[model samples]
Target: MKLPIYLDYNATTPVDKQVLDCLLPFFSENFGNAASRSHLYGWTAQEAVETARQQVADLIGAETKEIVFTSGATESNNLIIKGLFESSFPLKRHIITAETEHKAVLDVCKHLEKLGAEVSYLKPDNVGNITLEQVQKATREDTFLITVMFANNEIGTIQPIQAIGAWAKEKNICFHTDATQALGKISVNVNEMNIDALSLSGHKLYAPKGVGALYLKKKSPATHLMAQMDGGKHERGFRSGTLNVAGIVGLGKACELARNSLLFENQKLSVLRDKLEQGILQNVSNTQVNGNPTNRLPNLTNISFGGVDGENLLMSFRDIAVSSGSACTSASVEPSYVLKSIGLSDELAYASIRFSLGKYTTEAEIDFTIKYVREVVEALR
Candidate 1:
């Protein structure tokens, strides 16, 4: 049997070989507790960690001291939302975020709402893109923070972060964007955009998992956030516990490579994405694309095929690495919230599949998948 094709980049990504090379020394030869100050090994590890911090900062246009290493985007999101609220900053207690954010943000907001803090969830228009006007209307004089994701993982819709950030800046509200899906695939200049805080994951950008960075805008008054954990004084006491030296270094290298190669990679993936979308739509009947066409990430396509069950269609393409909303969330047996938000019915939402491309996706693979999908979709009908 041929090797299975992988297109579910939105879920996760494999580590790059270059990043792996940079991480190896930390696991064996140079292994030391970064927090231990008494020994040469410890100091060496600390230096390595700091150098990695610089690389991460360079990738996202932030200060070396502003990058806080954490477990992943989920942890970073928690730290940002909870820590900001808990900080001594003289701002309002209200938080504004979109309804389509990952469970990480949604759950945290729900938890905060339980604690008496008012939270406003702004739902985007049919294409899953939020408007600056909607944000302006939802925000209050007491609104302290506005957190929006740079891109949607399921539909690959890129948000108007710059406009939102500008509006938030004018209102003196702290703006945070979760760029986990956007960081590796797109260019994110936090300074030019006036983003107050941002989160990025390593694995999503071809580095190993277990490490991510939270970008804190320097001198933003929101820079000093409350630490979620308590232990050794690491990450300026904003995040406690000994640093993951190997993972951090890998993440830094990955960020550097991603920033350097973003444009070329996006251009390559755009062709494949177009082929996948156009082929499926032309070959199969009763299909529709989701999200803003030209304003989306270069490597993702979410298509809803009517009449056939998404799960059954997924089963037919057993060898391909595509995903159905039904398959990814099969444990729930419910329609996709993302699709429903964009005006798809329960059946259409259930029939949606997200095919996300990546750095290694090839023309032959796309051609084969398109052909296979056409055959399988027709057979299922």
Candidate 2:
């Protein structure tokens, strides 16, 4: 095992070697503008892009035509929220989301709120899971979109996305989920979940950064999203930009690998996560795991240690890379709102750390983290 262990897979994952190998040729020899249709290079590039699109689509049980590539999940979230809002502005002006959503979705919701859109942010239950009852009660005649995340990045809590999607379907409302954290960790089928649009990030699933996909159901009521960018009408005119061929290839290969290995990988991760969590809780006094004990991503655990500042705890473990909360909000001195939303006290929130395991995380690393974290907490307390 490496000295500086990485337990922050929810933030980003290192590109898989196979994915990297698939990406290298696209950067030089096979490089061509995907949009250019007048030459052989362009044809090859476009063909590669389409093939990658199919790979991404297949991972989520979406049709190839439904996949719209973007720079990353953040862009996908923006395109879904803003594009949907812009398409039906002044009419379907209400949106519903959960408070535990990543900042990408929350920030976009905030921006839309400033534009005369009514937004409802549902607070999670004590276990970091939102009740469907809350969403149903929050819905109104003007509510056209319900956006939520499939999993909580900080807590590893899985939401009932399929139930929410069913409700949305019955009400004729579009449902969008930020599946960035859930995609590779869980089995995500857009059709099974009844999701109208879904966002996934490449970096979250062992793919290269700066690549992601938005699954926009073709024959759904949610297909009327307005174009967020205007260039050469790329990505079926929904998002307009040159395709990142290398990055797309990497993303595709990663998704294929994930689809093939998810079962065994998640089972292994579950054991490691449990071992780490149990060891910490047993040896470290005043420590508690956050979020629902079950119904969460298999590869991660979030824990709050009493009387120790999270930043200080993190600093003490320089060899163990973890996080207090979402990478997007790590700079803030404030405690994690996600933890607070789940009824954690302010001090506990500040004392919390998210340790997200991954496909490559080893049993030896987990044992080391358990021993080291317990030691640090004992000294700090």
Candidate 3:
């Protein structure tokens, strides 16, 4: 196995070689503003951008016009949540989201709260799954949007988004999902789930950062979100700025590759994830896997060691790269809010480690990680 094994794919993935290859040409030879409509260079750039838009759209079962590129999921989340609230729709003064959602969504909700928007932050069950009943009970006539995450980044708990989406549809309320960590790991069909909007970052898959997309269903209420940024109307006035051509190209290629290989690759990842989880459980004492065991991403696991400091344990394994919380929140010394929201004590929350596998993760790395983690936890105890 390679030294300094990377098991933090949920944080971000290394851009795949093939994705990189597709990105390079857009940076130089085909460099032109996609908005420059009068020249051949612009035409080439526009074609590439449109193709990438379609590639991104296909992954989520959305139309190309539904895809609006952004800086990343944070911007996408902000655009949908804040934009919808700021739009001309009167009486849409409330929003609902889970407490376990990424800070992007959570923070946006907080910001909206200060703007006189009624926000309901639903807590998850012990297994990190929020129930559809909870969402239904929280809904009100003024609740214009219900934003849930497709998967928990730290615990890999997959939410019942399909059910929530259907409920939202029945209620004639818009539903959105932050699918950053879930996109390449599972099938994300907007139609199948009745999803009106979704936020996804390219870096979470095999593409570069600073490029993501928000899927806003055509002719849906979600498509009418007010533009957050001001400039020449780009992305159909939903977001305004020059696009990142190279990153978009990379994101498109990554999506295409993931669509082609996700089924076969996710199965392999699940086997590796299970081996690692099981090995640690059997060999190490005072250890528990966080989140629902069966209803999670195939390539992710969050484990908590009862008697060890997660930070010290992480420090002990210099040869392994992992995280104790979401990458955006890792620098904070406090226990993970997501874990705490699911009923874990501060001690257990602080003791947790998030290990996310990816397309490039191998059996050798999983075996090595299992043994290494077991030894460290035992030694620390």
Q: Tell me the lDDT of candidate 2.
A: 0.90
Q: TM-scores for all candidates?
A: 0.96, 0.98, 0.97
Overall lDDT per candidate, in order of appearance? 0.87, 0.90, 0.90
Put down candidate 2 lDDT per residue, 88-204, tens digits, no spaces: 889889999999898899999899999989999998889988889999999999998999899988888999999999999999999999999998788999999999999999999
User: Residues 136-220, candidate 3, lDDT per residue (tens digit)?
Assistant: 9999988899999999998989999999999999998889999998898999899999999999999999999999999999878
Q: What is the full ranking by TM-score, best candidate first? A: 2, 3, 1
Ten consecutive residues with minimal summed lDDT in candidate 1?
A: 323-332
Query: Which 10-residue span in candidate 2 carries the lowest summed lDDT?
Result: 324-333
State the RMSD for candidate 2: 1.3
Candidate 2: deviation at residue 72, Å? 0.4
State how far residue 17 of model 2 sits from its true place (Å): 0.4
Off by over 4 Å in 1: 88-91, 327-331
lDDT of 1 at 154: 84
